[model samples]
Target: MAGSRKIELTEALALGSEWRHMCFAILYAPDPRMLFGRIPLRYAVLMEMRFDGRLGFPGGFVNSQKRTLEDGLNRELLTKLGEAASAFSVERTEYRNSHAEDTTHVVAHFYAKRLTLEQLEAVEAGAPKAKDHGLEVLGLVRVPLYTLRDGVGGLPAFLENSFIGAAREVLLEALRDLELVEPGSVLNFKRHSFRQPSLNS
Candidate 1:
């Protein structure tokens, strides 16, 4: 095979028939006004959904006919953002979850895109009010890297999703990579504490 890794999707009826395999972006943008201006950080986070009625990244599941997860995610982003795939950079792929009941798992491909203040303003000015999913995404919101520690508040509910946990990790990792947070000083918020269980469960 030309690629060293591959993904396969399957329906797990026993696990509420939820199909495995998905992708997400850890969208980031450098902001200089926050945290007393001591840290040059990026806005990595969730946006309020316009259709699904939740917050999430600009991504989706791989089409069965697609050869790669990146392809599917790129397509979804373009469809939603009206931009080209080259507009963003794939930072890293993080393993979010794996199913033991079946040979299926979910992976989030975290992407990083730098936007200027003017670009951000323009994006906000002309962004679509909603996506094909009918989700009225209230545009992208910066994940507060400073408030990511314990006892902090204002985290979006969708960030607590089990599927998006990897996205969170990617955010943390990116923060660390950017020297915004010290190594090994990141917080671990419990997913179950905030996330609702599957309806069928």
Candidate 2:
């Protein structure tokens, strides 16, 4: 959090040779499927419930000395999404934002890619069998792209849950950037009623 500030992807890539790079992305599909025969599942975005009990996108560190950022990112995708990730790719053109954390000599890169519904499902189905499953990657979380009748559930509720670092920021930016959700709509969420979680839930 020291030397970190939002900068162009190219600028981040051009940093002096002292920085390490970590890349992550938001994988989403054009989902027209209906939920419970009523609610429309507009966009299916994948986020992981990390081992640390925080939510973040599916990806990991990329050693520039070993592989290109895109290649390293794909390698991580394969590890986290299992064989289903074979067909998915995140190109450099999809790069979104980059922030440099000078304190640790690390720079974070964010990406967003679109997949078909079928392809997305394959990733989801195969995630449980991925190499990092249940370890660094605890579970797959599909962002609820819609709001309930009272505007208090779905995305709003999902927002209430904890997110790690820039996960929440990237998610909101992607939602608006992709036109999956209208701009400024996320801020109008109604607060949810307080309820205790069940031990069995």
Candidate 3:
């Protein structure tokens, strides 16, 4: 019955409405050899539209008619990625709200899924053909732990803007569920400007 609450697009627009949020899993595979003694794991982030270009995860708003957040996300993934969605398993989720100081109350639900190396390969191979809402995703980025460190400076434009917090939270949850990352491995970074640092002499 809850899913039956149909908020028409026109009404939603009038109310400055918000839509459902979704994301795909960033999986890591352990590698036996690494110079820093850190686990060699494969990481993934979504390629979405931003001022700069495509970044972030594969997700979007939930259809009001769906029973759960997962239902909506799964539907969108399947629709956009086609058989690529079949390669991974969605393992966990988290829910939160937007921090914007506006009347439009927004709720976001993030999900994490794990895929085999072969599955990841399939996704990479299929990304060129995937399209959602007329946007063509560039595909997932395999981030290394050192990249999060190495004083590399910043995240991608879309990740910096949209799902930075959610990304850390969901990745931690996924790692914990899989017993991969340590309990505190997920570090929440403070919000910082993505603009290039000024070099005032």
Candidate 4:
């Protein structure tokens, strides 16, 4: 989905109870204040460059027969974050939203979790040993919160990066709901307008 220029969405289906469940998390930690650093001490979200080269949160299909959503999420966290999984508490996981996914008709369940700076460091430290690293995940990526918070009235560089399925919108929604970003900023981003060049030369 990332390599291609065209963006695609799953085909719409009738509202029904039957839907394949999937889950992902927008995990973040408060940025540590730096005396001198390019990336200021600000909150950041952990993301993954998936096998398909598309940016997305760390998670996978929910085996409803084997485990519940929470259980599945914990499993995914362990897989993606490795030993770093123990560094942070679950805090609270909310049912962010449910959206249909491409082709698979996957009903994606997204969650947002907060982590301590210590936990963030642990996650970074454990990245080299992440079980899914290089296999399902090409690499890790961080989306700085300041960019989104101040990225209104135009497309942010972060938004330019391709996201899997409905991840971009979902990420934005999570940020807005978490109070990390303003609703106006999100709204402005959605209504991004481009100026046309003058034809007369």
Top-lDDT structure, candidate number: 2
Mind giving the per-residue lDDT tens digits that candidate 1 earns over 139-165? 555555554334444343434544333
Model 3 bad stretches (over 4 Å): 1-39, 42-54, 88-102, 133-136, 147-165, 168-201
Model 4 worst lDDT run, 10 consecutive residues: 4-13
What TM-score would every model get versus the actual structure? 0.54, 0.88, 0.55, 0.75
Instruction: For candidate 3, list the clashing residue pairs, or say none.
Output: 25-113, 28-42, 29-42, 46-56, 46-57, 48-55
**Predictions in order: lDDT:** 0.47, 0.84, 0.46, 0.67
Model 4 misplaced regions, further than 4 Å: 1-18, 32-41, 89-93, 147-155, 193-201
Most accurate candidate by TM-score: 2
Q: What is the C-alpha lDDT profile of model 2 across 1-201, one tens digit per residue?
A: 333678787788788888888889899999887988999888899999999888999888888887889999999999988999998789989988987776787888898999998998999899999999988999898999988898677887788777777777778878877888766675554323434345596
lDDT of 3 by residue, 1-201 (tens): 111222333343344335433334343454334535753443443344422343445656565444455567676676566567766545434322221213324334445455555666676667656665345454455544333354443333322433333444444345446555344444433333444334472
Ranking by lDDT: 2, 4, 1, 3
lDDT of 2: 0.84
In model 1, which residue pairs have backbone atoms overlapping below 3 Å? 29-43, 50-135, 50-136, 50-137, 51-134, 51-135, 51-136
For model 3 the local lDDT of residue 111 reads 50
- What are the clashing pairs of model 2? none
Q: List where candidate 1 sits over 4 angstroms from the true fold.
A: 1-20, 35-50, 64-67, 84-86, 89-108, 114-121, 129-139, 148-170, 177-184, 188-201
